[model samples]
Target: MIAWFRQHGRALAAAVAKVRAQPMTSALSALVIGIALALPAGGYALLSNLSGIAQRTSIEPQLSLFMSTEAKAAETEALGKRLRADPRLAAVRFVPRNEALAALRRTGALAEVFAALEHNPLPDAFVLRPRDAAPDALDALAGEYRRLPGIAHAQIDSDWARRLAALIRLARSGIFLLGALLGIGLVAVTFNTIRMQILTQREEIEVAKLLGATDGFIRRPFFYLGVVQGLAGSVVALSIVSLSLAVLDRAVQSLAATYDASFQLSHLAPADAAAVAALAGFLGWLGACLSVSIYLRQIEPS
Candidate 1:
């Protein structure tokens, strides 16, 4: 046990010392990994916030059911009562023509224009809130409303929100593809870095082999070295991602406030952050293993 501990401890110390010796090279390699990782992390963060907005918009999706010009107040009231009684609907609010006109007048720019109109141009409308807010379900509900009595037209106010949700989903798939490609690049970079280190220590490796040192003994330090490099790179990547999110969150809050929306940007979940760090370290370790396997075989005590 003591011998095993001493040997492993020496390998770990050697690996750390080697990194300390070449801080610039180590940092630059880590920076490269960091940039590659940050692209996906940052994109995922943005997508998460957008998804939240989409969900809120979906849950409260409002359908505007406009009554026909000739529709009477009794028919409008009956339609409202009918919609309110539906099992699938959460709530329904009836907006009379006069109220609609009043709202138009409240808009500063359109107030004078609305005041000059001879007759109220707007028809009575019902603002609908559905119990189920799924896009397909909402569309189906809208279609049913259009066929109802006195409903001249039915339009969902959250159509843009549905589209936004779809776009965010598509963007997430694209980000995954891009992340896969970048992960390969990360592996390649680590592989080459390990290969170069192996070549530089060729003489020392040959001497160790001649002294009857096993392959595992020679490989330990390089393995440790790769892990260290990967961890350093992940630290840099996390820092960049965190800082970017901090800045973006502030900007998003300010923008949301302008529209009187209670929106806030979200950060990566704990599991996701851990996954990022784990993936980085795994890639580095795997790259080192591959390089060492190929190159170490070529330097056999010659």
Candidate 2:
């Protein structure tokens, strides 16, 4: 095990030295890989943040069942029970006229306005959350609620939620497609890079073969080189994405504060970062394996 570790360590060092020997080319190639990776990675990060914002900002459409002003408290309770029993509803909350008025009074600006009223004019109401948030389901439930005997108004406040959900879904599909394309591009980039390295060291490879070195031994340095390049690119991509998110977070926070909102941007999670690094390394290793298999076959002991 120690001997194996020593051999691998020497190959890793040799790979580093080769990259150091052509600093400009290596840096340029890694930069290209990083940019290609950053596009999709950055998109994924933005989409995740957008999804979080949408979830926080998008208010669930609630069915407000305002009863007729003459309706009694017993009637409201009966209706509330029926609404709760329905399979379509997740919850039903009854708000008495007095309670609703008190809630309005809690708002500092509206407290004095509500206090000036001669009497409590607000009607008893029921706020409902549906089990299914789909637009069609909400519309159907709203119609049913409106037809109830004492229900003076049944309003569904969900148009924005529906539109936002659809937009997020469409955006997610687009991001997925973009990521797939960029992933293929990354693999191709690594493949071409490895191919060039193989060509450059063709004579050395032949000499190694003549010295009784196995193909595995000859391929070790290139594998290390590819993996190192991939990891380096991943680091660059992560840096660019994090900096962008930081800048955007500041802007988002400033805008949110203007509306008295407590919104904050989310950063990439640790698991996601790990996945990105693993993906890059795996793709690099795959590209190197493909190139090595092709070129090594062509360079025999002859």
Whole-model alpha-carbon lDDT for candidate 1: 0.85
Quick one: best TM-score, which candidate?
1
Tens-place lDDT digits, model 2, residues 90-158:
888888899999998886656888999999999999889998987788889999889988899988866
Candidate 1's clash total is 0
Candidate 2, lDDT over the whole model:
0.83
CA deviation > 4 Å runs, candidate 2: 51-62, 67-90, 96-124, 130-138, 149-152, 157-170, 300-302
Q: Give me the candidate number with maximum lDDT.
A: 1
In model 1, the runs with Cα more than 4 Å from the true position are 59-63, 81-123, 127-149, 300-302
For candidate 1, lDDT tens digit of each residue in 276-302? Answer: 889898888888888888876887644
